[model samples]
Target chain A: MTRIACRQLAPRIGDLPFNRELSAAAIRDAAGADVIVLPELVTSGYMFASPAEAAAVAVRPDHPLFAEWAAAAGDAVVIGGFCERGDDGLLYNSAAVVDRGGVRAVYRKTHLWDAEKSVFTPGDRPPPVVRTSAGPIGVLICYDLEFPEMTRLLALGGAHLIAAPVNWPLVERPPGERPPETVIAMAAARVNRTFIACCDRAGTERGQEWTLGTAIISPDGQVLAEAGEGAQATADVDLLLARSKALNSRNDVLADRRPDLYSPLLHRRAPS
Target chain B: MTRIACRQLAPRIGDLPFNRELSAAAIRDAAGADVIVLPELVTSGYMFASPAEAAAVAVRPDHPLFAEWAAAAGDAVVIGGFCERGDDGLLYNSAAVVDRGGVRAVYRKTHLWDAEKSVFTPGDRPPPVVRTSAGPIGVLICYDLEFPEMTRLLALGGAHLIAAPVNWPLVERPPGERPPETVIAMAAARVNRTFIACCDRAGTERGQEWTLGTAIISPDGQVLAEAGEGAQATADVDLLLARSKALNSRNDVLADRRPDLYSPLLHRRAPS
Candidate 1:
């Protein structure tokens, strides 16, 4: 069993010190969790005014603030998104996986969302799967999860659990309903037969309202646990269940793919 | 405004003549509809005992039955799945789009399900967008809908509405809830911002139970119309709504795709 905790936080733009303290506090509260996930841009917040501003707020994995959070996490694994300063000196929307030892993996956001295209450079590579106490956990940032290709690749790479850190802006939907972001996560989890943990930020930023919650979905596509709007969510799940990608006695989702016919999917040209 | 009708049928194996009559009657019933969709393998029931059994039930596009159905269809466009005997002498699980002008498009099943892999030849090409009076209609069959690549391609090809003819086998899910198939359809529709009409067949065939119903989802991922278990469902919706893929002032789903990072999707190797 993997005890997972999701922190839905509302970080202020450019408030690095305050966001770091908030994340550290969340980690301290989740003392017994095997893994704790925080939302995208949780360290500096989204909606940057300029590329230079975004770059200015980006941090290195070895930054002292990350070390403080890692210490607070103790033995538990922590996954959270931050503005990143890559070795190439470009700013990236990246998520890092941390443990008591140090930073284990850092994944740059491959699919940038609206306005982010102008602010941060899109990561060229897909996120890497890191071995964990429960199983291999794949990390992805906001908007990256919208592309099925991203999650499918992680699942194909043998990820037992996908940890998504999101700052989801509310889209128009029927009144009294879960946001489309949550619905998309549920579908992706079912199709890939992989356990998914989504941590979305709460509160509005620059007139953009967020979903303000966390949703943990099982391989069967059912919500195992969810936070009522603006609440922190936690759940313990058997990660072993996700290792089996079989839908029935004879059908396995990943094995059933027809790669030969999927060539167009890879070489997709921008919508004409 | 486009009037869409979905025929939820229970076809018998090898009963081509009877199935033809049933389909024609449904077309007659949907006379006022702009487009009507039928279930996968509607002409010949699914669950073939052998390749020979499937081949025996397969028909050609120029088959007399199709012509009669087209004539009965009159002015309205019809889309339905059928077993096909390709020119290469291979059997395929295919869907034909027929109108007053005759057969407009034929799409063979690209992603064959369970026993279908052994009996049917997978389609070589992707589904096409056939221009219609209502809008561009994209057709995909059964298992093909499970792959996001298939739907994304059609959406990129400028399809306003995706007509999916499915024969959905009931899968385990939370009780008294919409099946994962419906959820996936809704998610796909929302993500692509495309209107989707899924017509599913009812009843058991050779001991295989099915989710008997039909669901039409709008671009916002809300159900426009749905039939109760084992009923023919119909609804009229504005296909023009799907033409606007923009979620807000700044975001458009199709235009936001990061084609550069999706290369891994194209060079997929079958899962080990």
Candidate 2:
């Protein structure tokens, strides 16, 4: 069994020093877990007024904070989001996959959310599936989870588990229903037959409340653990179970795909 | 506003004459609805013992049954499934879109489910989005909804509503939870910002039970109506609402797709 833990922390806006310690502490607390996840923009809180404000807290991948997180993680793999300062001097909404050694992979957020278009540049490359001590872990940022193609690609790339760091802004939903983003994640997990851990941030930032819908979904699309008015959600699951996409004797989800008929999805324009 | 109705009628296995009257009666009962949906293989029930058993009731597009359905439909559009006899003498699991004007389009199930592979030929063509009096309606059959690419492609093809004919086999799920298939449909609707009406069959055939999870979902991914121990589920919705994929000022669901980075999904082989 692989233990997965998600920390739903509240980051102070533009306060990198405070968040750095908070994230490291969370990682240390869940050090025994095989995988630990933190919310998107946990290092620099979301709801920035301008690009300059976001850039103020942005850090490069080599920043010492990752090393701290690595040290705290021990044998576990940690996936958490940050405001990134790219080599090209542009800002990006990025997530880093770190183990005891160091930063293993960095994936920039491809599909930016509502106000993020003005604050960060969208990523050009696809998210990575890093081979970790726990298993193969795929990484995706907040809004990227909404795109089915993104999850499909990661699953096809042989990811046993997908760690998503999302800051889902509060939206109106019917009473007793889960957040829409969580529903999307559940569907993605079931269709791909892959485990998914979505870490959502807590607390309101600049009058914007969050859904706070952190969840750890099993391969069968069941919510094994959910952070309900809590700072953490954890679950112990057989991650290897996700490696088999078969639903029954004859039906394997990944093997059943008809890619040749999917070329229409490659077109950029919406039908008129 | 479009009045969408789904009739969850149970078909007798290998009894086409009985099912033909059953479906036509249901369509006539909901003739006032703008769109009416029926379960997959409603004409020839699921659980065929052999390919010959399925082919015994397979139909062509020009079958008189469709004309009967058109007559019963009045001004409404009807979308339902059947075992199809192709020109090449192969059998397919297919759905037909019909109206007072007769058959608008026929879409064969591209993704066949368990046991279906042994009885039907997989479709080479993509599902079609047909322009109807109600709105632009896309078609999918049974297991096809599980494939995110199928839904994504249909939504991208300017479908305001996806009319699906599904025969969901009963599967194990946690108590008090909706069927997994319904969950998948909800997620697909939300991500694509398109309304979906899934018509599921009822009753047991050959000792095989059904999920009976027929649901009509809004663009926001909320269930507008569900068939609960009943033969019908109906909802009044503005189909045009799905045309705008905008969630907020800067985020439009369809416009946010990064197709350039999705080439990996076109590959058929699983990663080793």
Candidate 3:
């Protein structure tokens, strides 16, 4: 069994020094787990008013902040979101995969959420499935999880678990229902037959209340653990169960894909 | 507003005459609804013992059975599944869309489920988004809902509502959880910003129990209505809500798609 933990922490906007320590502490707190996840923009809180404000807290991949996470991670592989300052001088909403060896992979968020388009340049490349000590872990930022193609891509790339760093802004839902984003995640997990750990931020930031809907979902699309009036959601999961996409003797999820008929998805459709 | 009704009927296997009347009666019973959906293979039933057994009950698009449904349908558009005998002599698991105008479109199940592979030839063409009096309604059959690509394709094709005809076999699920198939449909509905009505068969056939998980979901991914201990799941939904893909002013679900990065979905990946 692989132990996965998600720390739902509140990051102070434009406060790098404070966030750096808070994230590192969260990682240390979850040190025993095989995989640890923190919410999106853990190093720099969301709701940026301008590009300059976002750039103020943006850090390069080589920044010492990752090394701090690596030091605290112990043997666990830590995945967390950050404000990224790329070599080309553009800011990106990105996530970094850090293990004991330091930064292993960095994935820029390709699908930016509302108002993010004004502050960050969308990543050109697809999300990465980084091979880790626990397993091959796929990385996706908040809005990316809403895209079924993104999850399907990662699953096809042989990812056993997908660690998503999301800062889900509060949305209205019917009473007794889970957050819409969580529902989307559950569907993605079941269809791909892959485990998913979504780490969502907590606390209200600039009047934008977070959903605080961190969840660790199993391959069967069950919520093994969830952050409910708590700071962490953790689960011990058999990551190897995701290695086989078969649901029964005759049906394998990945093998049953009809890719030849999916060409329409490659082109954008005109608005209805 | 569209009054969608899903009739969860029990079809007796290998008894086409009985099933034909049962489905026509179901359509007539749901005549007041704007859109009526029926279970997959409602005309032939599932769990065939052999290809010959399936072939015995297979039908073509021009079969008089659909005319019976159309005659009883009134103004409502009806979508239901059947065992299809193709003109080329191959058998297919397919769904037909009918209205007062007769058969509008036929979509073969592209993703065949477990045990279905043994008796039916897989559909080469993509599922159809048939333009109807109610709106453009997409059709999917059984396991086809498990494939995110199929739903995404129909949503892109300007479908306001997706009508799925499913014969969901009973599967183990964690207590207090909805069926996994329903979860997948909810996710597909939300991500695509489209409404979905899944009509699932009820009762056991050949000792194969059904999930009886028929559901009507809104664009927001909430369960508008579900078949609990009842024979039908009905919901009065604003289909126009799905026409505007916008969640907010800045986020349009369909516009946010990064189709350029979705090329990976067009090719099959080696099994993990």
Question: Going through the candidates in order, what is the number of backbone clashes in each?
Answer: 1, 0, 0
lDDT (C-alpha) at residue A229 in model 1: 51
- The interface RMSD value for candidate 3 stands at 1.9
What DockQ values do the models have? 0.50, 0.73, 0.65
Q: Kindly report the docking quality category of candidate 3.
A: medium
* Tens digits of per-residue lDDT for model 3, A1-272: 99999999999999999999999999988867999999999999998988999999999999999999999999999999999999999999999999999999999999888899899999999898898999899999998999988999889989999999999998899887788899899999998999999999987789999898899998888899988543889899899999999988988888888777786554656444
- For model 2, residues A1-272, the per-residue Cα lDDT tens digits are 99999999999899999999999999999967999999999999998989999999999999999999999999999999999999999999999999988999999999999889998999999999999999999999989999998888999999999999999998999888888898999999999999999999998889999998999999899899988543789999999999999999988888998887877554545755
What are the per-residue Cα lDDT tens digits for candidate 1 across B83-170? 9999899999999999888899999988778778789988988888899777799998877777777777888888889999999997
lDDT of 2 at A195: 96
> Judged by TM-score relative to the true structure, which candidate is superior, 1 or 3?
3
Worst 10 residues of 2 chain A by lDDT: A263-272
Off by over 4 Å in 3: B228-230
The true-versus-predicted C-alpha distance at residue A5 of model 3, in Å, is 1.0
TM-score (all chains, Cα) for each model: 0.93, 0.98, 0.97
Q: lDDT, candidate 2, residue B68?
A: 91
- Summarize candidate 1's per-residue lDDT along A89-141 as a digit string, tens digits: 99999999998888998999877877887888888886888997667999988
Interface Cα root-mean-square deviation for all models:
2.5, 1.5, 1.9
- Each candidate's fnat, listed in order, reads 0.44, 0.73, 0.63
